[model samples]
Target: MTDLHTHILPFTDDGATDFDDALDMAEMAAENGTEIIAATPHFNIPGIQSRSVSEIKDTFEQMKNKIEKNKIDISFVLGMEIFASPTVGEKLDCGELITLNGTRYPLIEFGFSEKKDFIFSVMDDLISRSYTPILAHPERYDCFISDLQSLYELYQMGVVIQINKGSILGRFGRRVQRTADAILCHRLAAVAASDAHSPITRTPDLSEFVRVLDMNYGDGCSPLLLEENPKRILRNEDVFWESPIPFDYQR
Candidate 1:
C-alpha cells in the first residue's frame, strides 16, 4: 500500500518533534503495509512558516538515511499540507509550495470560516498555472460539512479530493464521519490517507482504514482507495475512477 498524505518529516512543522519521531513513524508505517509515503509537513499556515522545498528535500534525505540505518524498508516522497492563504499563489510562484510525488497534484487546506467564495478562485489560480489542486481532508472542513454539495461541485471542477482515514473510522466525530460516508458513496474521494502525526494520537497506520473500508464498502473497495489510487498518483498517472451510480453500483 501507498500513503499519499503524511506528516513524518521531523521538526518541519507540527508533525514529528525530532529525527527519532520520524523514524518511529516510518517504522509504524512499514508495519502497517505502507511501502511509500509522501512526507507532507505543514507549510504556510497562520503564523507558521515551515521549511522550504530545498530544505524539505534535505530533511527527506536525512529521514531516508535514518530509515536505511534502521533497516526499515519504506520510500519517502516530497509534499506539503499547504494551508491555503491569500498569498498561496505567490508562494507557489516563489517555490514555497510542495507537490505530492513532484507532480501537479498539490495538497491544500483552508480556514474554518466561510471562504467559499475564495475556494474555487484559489484552485483556479493554481489550475491556471498547470497545478491540479487536491483539497486535503475536505470532509473535516466545517464549510464543506455544512454544505456537502459544494464538495461535489469542486470535484466536478477537476479538483481531486482526499479523505482522511480517521474520519471514516469516526475518529473526528459525527459531522466528519457523515461527510466521509457521503464522499465514499458518491465516489468523490480518489484516495484515502492517514494524515498521521505521531505514533499514538495521530499514528501513521493504515490498518484501521483498510478494515473500516472493507467492512463498510466491501473488501474490494479498500484497495482502490488505499493502494491503487495512491500508486497511480505517485506515478503521475491519471487515477482511473468510475463515478458510483445512484442505483448503488460501482459503475
Candidate 2:
C-alpha cells in the first residue's frame, strides 16, 4: 500500500519532532504493509509559517538517509497538504509548493468550518491553473458534514476525495467516522490515507482500516482505495471510481 498523505518529515511541521521520530513512524508503516508514503507536511496556514519547498526537500532527504541507515524498507516522496487560499494558484505557479510525487495532483484542505462557496472558489482557481486538487479528509469538515451534497458536487467537478484512515477508525470523532463511512459506502472516496502525524497519536498504520473495509464493504474495497487509485494518482493517471450511491442524509 502507498500512503499518499502524511506528516513524517522532521522539523518541517507538527509531525515528527526529530529524525528518530520520523524513522520510528516509517518503521511502523513498513511493518503495517505500507510500501511508499508521501511526506506531506502542512503548508500555508493562517498563523503558521510553513517550511519552504527547498526546506521540505532538505528535511525529506535527511529522513530518507535515516530510513536507509535504519533499514526501513519504505519509500518517501515529497508533497504538501496545502491550506486553501486565494493565492494558492500563484504559489503553485511560482514553484513555492509541490504536488504529490511531483504529479499534477496537489492535496489541499479547507478550514474545518469553511463554507462551501469558499472551498469551491479555491478549488476552481486551482483547477483553472491546471492542477487537480485532491480534497484531504473532507469528512472532518463541518460544511460537508452539515450538507454532504456539497461534497458530491465537488466530486462531480473532478476533485478527488481522500478520507483519513483515522476518521474511519473513529479517532477524530463519531461525526467524522459516520461521514467517512457514508463517503465509502457511497463509493465517493477515491483514496484512503494514514494522514499520520506522529509515531503515536496518528501513527502510520493502514492495516486496521483495510481489515475493516474488507470485512464490511467487501474484499475488493481495500485494494481499490489503498492501492489502485492511489497508485494512479502517483503516476498522474486518471482514477476510475466506482459508481456512487446517494448519501442517505436522513440516516
Candidate 3:
C-alpha cells in the first residue's frame, strides 16, 4: 500500500517527535502492509509556526537514512498537506511549497468550518493553473459534510477527494464517519490515505485499513485506493478515477 498522507517527518510539525519515533512509525507501517509513504507534514496554516522546505527536506533525508540503516522495507516521499490561502499559488510557483512527490497534484486542506466558496475558490485557482489539488480528509470538514452536493460538484470539477482512514473507521467522530460513508456510497472519494501522525495515536498501521475496505467495499476497491492511485500520484501519472454518483439535493 502507498499511504499518500502522513506526518512521519520528525520535528517539522505535529508528527513524530524524533528520529527514533519516526523509525518506529515506519516499522509499524511496513508491518501493517504499507510499502510506500509520503511524509506530508502540515504546512502554512494561519497563525501556526512553519518550517522551511530545506529544513523539512533535511529531516526527511535523515529519516530515509535511518530507515535504510534499520533495513525497514518502505519508501518515503516528501510533501506537505498545504493549508489553503491566497499566497499558496505564489508559494508553489516559487518552490516554497511542493506537490506530492513533485507531481502536479498537490494535497491540500482547509479550515474545517471554512465556507464552500473559499474552498472552491482556491481549488479553482489551482485547477485553472493546471495543478490538480487533492483535498485531504474532506469528510472531517463541516463544509462538505453539510453540503454533500457541493462535494459531488468538486468531483465533477476534477478535484481528487482524498478521504482519511480515521474518518472511514469513525476514529475522528461519528459525524465525520457518517460523512465518510456518504462520500464512499456516492464514490466521491477517489483516494484514501492513513494521515498517520505517530506510532501510537493516529498511527500508520494499515492492516485494519486493508481489512475494512476488503470487507465493506470488496472487488478491487482496496487495491485501487490503497495502491494503484497512490502509485500513480508518486509517478506523476494520471490517476484512474470513478465517476461520483450525484446527490438529489435541490440546488
Candidate 4:
C-alpha cells in the first residue's frame, strides 16, 4: 500500500526526534504493508515549527540511506502538509512549499475549529491558479463534522477529502471517529492516510485500519480508499471518485 501522509522524516515537526525513531517508524510501516510512503511533515503552521524544504529533503535522504543500509524494503517520497494560510499561494509560486508529486495537487490542512469564508477563498485561489487542493482529514474539522452539507459543498467546489486512518478507527476521539464514519458512508472522503508520527504512540501503520474498512464496507472498499485513490494523487491524474454515500445520521 502507498501511504500519502506521514511524519517519518527525522527531527522535523512533531514526528520522530532522531534517526532511531525514524528507523523504528519505518519498520512499523513496513510491517503494516506500506511499500511507498510520502514523508509529509507539517509546514507553515502559525506556531508549530517545521523543517524547510531543503532541510526536509536532507532528512529524507538520510532516512533513505539508512533504510538502504539496513535493507528495509520501503520507498519514501517528499511532500509537505501545508497549513491553509493567506500566504499559501505566494509560497507555492516561490517554490518554497512542496506539492504532491510536484504537480498541481496540494494537500492542505486547517486547524480543528470553526470555518470561515477565507478558508474557502484560499481553496478558490488555488483552483484559480489551476491547483487541485485535497483537504487532509476533513473529517476532523469541527465545523464540517456536524454539517455534512457544507462538506458536500466543498466537494462540489473541487476539493478532495482525505480521512485519517486513526480517525477511521476512533483513535483520535469519538467525535472524529463519528465524522470519519460519516465521510465513508457518504463517500465524501476520497483517500485515506496513516498520518503516522512515531513508532509507538503515533506510529506509522495502516493494517489495523484497513482491516476495519474491509470488515465494515467490503474488500473492494479497502483498495479504493487505501491504494487506487492515493495512486491518483501521487501521479497527478484525475480521480475517478465513487458517488457519495447518502448520509445515515442515525448512527
Candidate 5:
C-alpha cells in the first residue's frame, strides 16, 4: 500500500516529535504493509511559522538517509500539506509550495469550518493554473458534511478527494466515520492514507483499515484505495474510479 499523506518529518510541524519517533513511525508503516509514504508536513498554516522550501527539502533528505541507515525498507516522497489560503495558488505557481513527489497534484487542506464557496474558489483557481488539488480529509469538514452537493461539484470540477484512515477506523468519532463512509460509498474518494502523525497515536499503521475496507466494502477495495490509485497518483498518471453513485438514486 502507498500512504499518500503523512507527517513523519521529525521536528517538523505537529507530527513525529524527533528522529526516534519518525523512525518508529516508518517501521510501523512498513510492518503494516505500506510500501510508499509521502512525508507531508503542515505548511502555510496561519499563526505558525512554516519551514522554507529549501529547509523542508533538507529535512526530508535527512530523514530518508536515516531510514536507509536503519534499513526499514520503505520509500519516501517529499511534499507539503499546503494550507488553503488566498495566496496558495501564487505560492505554488512561484514554486514556494510543492506537490506530492513534485507532481501536478498538490495536497491541500482548509479550515474545517471554512465557507463552501471559498473552498471551491481556491480549488478552481488551482485547477485553472493547470494543477490538480487533492482535498485532504473532506469528511472532517463541517461545510462538506452540510453540503454533499458541493463535494459532488468539486469532484465534477476535477478535484481529487482524499479520505483519511482515521476517519475510516472511527478514530475521529461516528460523525466523521459516517461522512467518510459516504465518500467511499459514493465512489467520491480517489485515495486513502494514514494521515499518520505519530508512533504512539494516529500512527502510520494501515493493515487494520485495509481489513475493515475489505470486510465491509468488498475484496476489491484494497487494490483501488491502497495500491493502484495511489501508485498512479505518485506517477502523475490518470487514476481510475467508478462513477460516483448519486446519494439520491432517483435524482
Candidate 6:
C-alpha cells in the first residue's frame, strides 16, 4: 500500500519532532504493509511557515540516507499539503511550493469553516491553471459535513477527494467517521491516506482500515483506494474514478 499523505519529516511541521521519530514512523508504516509514503508537511498556513522546497528536499535526502543506513524498506517522496490561498498559483509557478511527487496534483486543505464559494473559487483557480487539486480530508470540514452537496459540487469541479484512515476508524470524531463512510458508500472518495502526524498518535498504518474496507465494501475497494489511485497521482496520470452517487442528506 502507498500512503499518499503523511507528515513524517522531522522538524518540518507539526509532525515528527526529530529524525528518530520520523524513522520510527517509517518503520511502523513498513510493518503495517505500506511500501511507499509521501512525506507531506504543512505549507503556507498563517503564522506557520514550514521548510522551503529546497530545505525540504535537503531534509528528504538526509532522511533517505538514514533510511538506507538503517535498512528500513520504505520509499519516501517529497510533497506538501498546501493551504488554500489566493497566491497559491503564483507560489507554484515560482517554485515556492511543490505538488505531490512533482506531479500536477497538489494536496490542498482549506480552513475548517471556509465558505463553499471560497473553496470553489480556490479550486477553480487551481484547475484553470491546469493543476489538479486533491482535497484533503473533506469529511473533516464543517461546511462539507453539514451540507455534503458542497462536497459533491467540488468533486464535479475536478477536485479529487482524499479521506483519512483515522477518520474512517472514528479516531477523529463520530461526525467525521459518518461522513467518511457516507463518501465511501457513495463512491466519491478517490484516495485513502494515513494523514499521520506522529509516530505514536496518528501513526502511519493502513492495515486495519484495509481489513475493514475489504470486509464491508469487498476486497477490491482497498486496492483501488490505497494503491491504484495513489500510484496514478505519483505518475501524474488521470485517476480511474467512478461517477459518485450523490450523497443523500436525509441519511
Error of 2 at 123 (Å): 1.1
User: Which parts of model 5 have CA positions greater than 4 angstroms off?
Assistant: 248-251
Model 5 has an lDDT value of 0.90
In candidate 2, stretches whose alpha carbon ends up further than 4 angstroms from where it belongs are 248-251
Clashing pairs in 5: none
For candidate 6, give the lDDT of residue 233: 94
Judge candidate 1 against the unseen true structure and give its global Cα lDDT, from 0 to 1: 0.83
Model 6 C-alpha lDDT per residue in residues 86-170, reported as the tens digit of each score: 9898898788989999999999998888888888888999999999999999999988888887788888888999999899999
Off by over 4 Å in 6: 248-251
**Model 4 residue 96 CA deviation in Å:** 1.2
Worst ten in a row by lDDT for model 4: 242-251
Model 2: worst 10 consecutive residues (lDDT sum): 242-251
By summed lDDT, the worst window of 10 consecutive residues in model 1 runs over 242-251
> What TM-score does model 1 achieve against the real structure?
0.93
Give the clashing residue pairs of candidate 4, or none.
186-245
Q: Write the per-residue lDDT of candidate 1 for residues 1-251, one digit (tens) a residue.
A: 88888889997887899998888899999998999988888888777656667888988888888899999998888888988876787777777776887787889988756467788888888888888788889888877887777777787777888899889989989988988898888778888899999877778888878888889887767788878988888888887665743323221
Question: Which of 2 and 4 is ahead in lDDT?
Answer: 2
Query: What value does the lDDT take at residue 57 in candidate 3?
Result: 87
In the range 104-155, model 3's lDDT, one tens digit per residue, is 9999999999999999999998998888899999988887878899999988
Q: lDDT values of the candidates?
A: 0.83, 0.89, 0.89, 0.83, 0.90, 0.90
